[model samples]
Target: MTLHQQIKAASLAALQALYPEQAFELDQIAVNQTKPEFTGHYTVVLFPFVKTLRCKPNELGEKLGDYLLAHTSLFSAHQTVSGFLNLSIKDQVFTDLLLHNFNNPNFGKAAPKSKKVMLEYSSPNTNKPLHFGHLRNIFLGYATANILKNDGQEVIKANLVNDRGIHICKSMIAWQDYGNGATPSSTGIKGDHLVGDYYVRFNNEYKKQIAALVSQGMDATQAEKEAPIMQATQAMLRDWEKGDENVRQLWKMMNDWVYEGFNNTYARLGVDFDKYYFESNTYLLGKQLVESGLANGILYQKEDHSVWVDLSDEGLDQKLLLRGDGTSVYMTQDLGTAKLKYDDYGIDQSIYVIADEQNYHMQVLQIILKKLGEPCWKGIYHLSYGMVELPSGRMKSREGTVVDADDMMDEMIVLAKEQTEAAGKTEGFSDAELQDLYEMIGMGALKFYLLRVEPKKKMIFDPKESIDLHGFTATFIQYAHARICSILRRENLPIMPDSSHFQGFVASEKLTDAEGKLLLSLEQFPEVLKAAANEYSPAIVCNYAFGLAQLFNSFYDNHPIAKAATDEKKNLRLMLIVMTAQVLRQGMNLLGIRLPEKM
Candidate 1:
């Protein structure tokens, strides 16, 4: 148990030992960190027990504090401040905790729980390259997956590629008509980028066709509906659905190009998926499930011969499942994919990393699944995150207004290089080595900036400030880790000692206040990981890592480590610094960030 938990358990035990017939769970006990003005490690809330014990707040608190000091070995002394009983813990508790984990790299990580979970993120479309919004989704999903894995949960990272639809047909149509047998190699552009160019080309050409029809005396709206490009795209979708050999070959060839580009981006972003689910394969699986729903009379058919489910009883409108022409909608594919994933992995939960715009869609989907008597419906969780807006406003794919992911990362690396070189910290480095460091710092800054905020809130990303050496940036945390390394190098101390040979901290006659404060924060790492896992928020780890780094900096500033009053004090300071770096590395690892040994 942690020190906070230990004190809480003991306080509950003390209260019951003092007053019989009183029942209290540990969670009901409110324990907070003692204020700096108070000479204690933690404080207990005593006001709630005033009426339950039939005693004044001060009187009952004093009685409880006296009992805790005398009977509990957790604390050495206690004092009542404004009805809150503050308890000072024994220093040896902190010392023992630090010694056990000072050199252990996985100190705060949990043991395997043996339960399996499936996380799906970065559901990119094959029609376009990744953009800024995708970067947010990718970072959030990757960080959360790593957090769960570090917490000892078996996680299967999956990606559902939207490789089919009218959108894909538009790009294919544009490529077929406008291209002079061009490929990624022929044009020397990325596969996804080349495909995306045709997608935009389709929009521009469609608009031209619409204006010409309007000038020719056709209704604007009707012209849009009657355009030849629109007709050809629809025909292509139908042909593809019917397994036309030419269309199928074209679809496979184009999607392969997009996947190659996507894999490169994922590699640079440090994200990987165990399985890839294609819309082409899973779109038809749910037809049977929808048929079962229809047979059970849970779903109804409209006069137009379309299929839908009436969720008005659940305060939702009827949702379309399949069209009158026997073509499946996106919802049908989702159902099939959900069942496919469950049957393949036997996962306890499936988290879909989607945007906040689809909130209503996901809710309706879960209800439909539940009404269909599917057990996996309960395991469906939509990790809905907000969009990434620029300083100007929202972006449009058809307008080509979104920031490309590759372009953004390149800009960040440039900024990282500028800032690092201006700092004049590097003494010697080869060109390749410097470039690698630039990428690490650059990508670390981007990931940390994006993941630092809560996933539900839309954030305006500023690339310039993200690489700042000060402030709450990952660069600051990296500098802290690097500082520790520099210190170790100066002292000629081994960074990782043999676990069996970890010499216990010297017998310091007395521990300083700074050392105690640092240890208290170090002890909270495991708790932070568990809380982050429960909440499914990477923001939790970001907050914890920044705070720990700040605390270590404060300790470094106030204490003299290289030359101390005694050898024992020096030993304690060294071990404390080592443990601080260990915790920082573990916490940042879960956030998909790397710490450079030198800045």
Candidate 2:
């Protein structure tokens, strides 16, 4: 067994032996290598066993520490404070774990047999171009899937497009009226952005029509009816539903353009999806489910003939399944999508990465799916994260105030390029080289900034703070890896270690504080990965990367791996440094961020 596993096993064995009838089950054995004002390389907690042991906290901790030290070679010394047992492992044991990591590149990705999991996010509407908010959703969804896959779960990444809606018809109406020959290229705008502009233009014209009617002393409802934009949009929707050839062709054309633009951004961001679902296709499928529900009497029709499900007892209002005119609502399409996914993927679990604002809607979905007799309802998870708000307030698309995703990416690239120029790294770089590096740094910064925050907490997106790459940022971590590579290159070391050189390396009693701490941090990576998987939190991995980088920086400031007096100690330290680099790379990969060889 590995050293960590051995340590945990020894600890567990002692606990079981000391309290024979206490039914001690090991929950977790963390390595809190740092104490507030103490001396220890690892602190373990035995609080969970206190109830069964029926002893005071201090007594229980002391007994466990005594049991572990006497029975196991895992710790050289240990102490108990309150209910916590702080144990320092033998230096050789810690070094052995580092060597193991150095040998195995995929140190933290081990797992049992994998199971299938479905993940869905980035459900953008066809009416408008994707914006900065969609970037958050896409990044989280993509990163979560990577982490789960790394943890040995088979993941299916998917997205849903809201294609058939009133908002979409607004774009179509404006295109028909004022976009006779105005293509995206002709107007020097992206296809999705161009279509979205027309959507905004339609609203503006409709508002003018409303104002004109209001001046004529008409009420708001009358003014809305009198507006030609509304009439045109309604006519387009009718034709779209009726499968009119001209309308279908135009819809396909516009949707293709928007999708092309979306794909380009997705490529740049290093995000991908295994499948796509469209509301146009799923809405009809939902109508079928609604019909089935009505036939089975699981759903009832109101006096107005609108199909509704009563969930009032669950502290939720009755929700509509189908409108009086038989049009499917948002819930209808989601219900259909869930059923379809069961047949297509048979996922063991399905997670939806959505904003916390839709908590109510998702709850309703879960309940409705259960009432509909779907077995997978119990397995559906709404991985709700809080909003990414600006300093001013939340973004509202209807007000034309949402930050466009493509524009934001372009701006980030520009900023990255400017930084590269200021750093004087662009002197010998070609345009192609500059473009590649800019994309890496730009998207890396963006993804890291979003992933570093706790997914459920509301975060303020400050460009000024995010662009600073010196501390706890993607560029900082990437720079650490690059620095290691530069030093290794100058020394002409092999990429992989020489096992002959690794055996019987001499110890250094004169190690610096930072080197010791960094070595300690390297040993906790496997445990960190396991914790991240267990808690379903990418922020755990992010925090680990930040801590590792900080420790490595400290070591670089104090110790020189290249100029050490002893080759044995120098090679050993370099091995630890390489192991640290691998951990950072692996962690960043789980968050869907890449490391550039140089910066």
Which candidate number would show the highest lDDT if scored against the true structure? Answer: 1
Worst 10 residues of 1 by lDDT: 497-506
Report the C-alpha displacement of residue 366, candidate 2, in angstroms. 0.8
- Can you give the TM-score per candidate against the true fold? 0.97, 0.93
Candidate 2 per-residue lDDT over residues 1-599, each given as its tens digit: 44456666777788778877756455555534548476666676766666766788788778878888888777777888767777776776666676666757778885754578899988888877888778888888988888888878899999888888788888888887889858777887788888888888898899999999899899999889978789888888899999999988888888877887787778878889999988888887777877888889988999888999988878888899999998888899888898888779989888999999999888999899898888879879988888987777888776797877887788878888888889887766778877988887888887888888888898777544535655778888988887887677777765455566466766654445566677778877877887786666788988999889888877877778888768866877788787888888889998888877667
Minimal lDDT window, size 10, model 2: 25-34
- List the candidate 2 regions with Cα displacement exceeding 4 Å: 1-9, 19-36, 45-63, 81-84, 426-431, 462-466, 494-512
Over 1-599, each residue of candidate 1 has an lDDT whose tens digit, in order, gives 77778888988898888887998778878999999999998999988887878887778778888898788777778888888998888788788787787887877788999778899999999999999899999999999999889889999999999999999999999999997779999999999999999999999999999999999999999999899999999999989998999999999989999999999999999989999898888889988899889999999888887899999899878899988977788899898899889999999888989999999988988888899998889889999898988777787789998888998889889888988889885568778888988998899988998898999999776543444546798887888888887777676786654444335545546677888888888988998888999889999999989988988888888788878787778777778888888888888888889998777
The lDDT of model 1 is 0.87
Error of 2 at 278 (Å): 1.4
Report, for every candidate in turn, its global Cα lDDT versus the true structure.
0.87, 0.80
Error of 1 at 299 (Å): 1.2
All candidates: CA RMSD in angstroms?
1.6, 2.7
In terms of lDDT, model 2 sits at 0.80
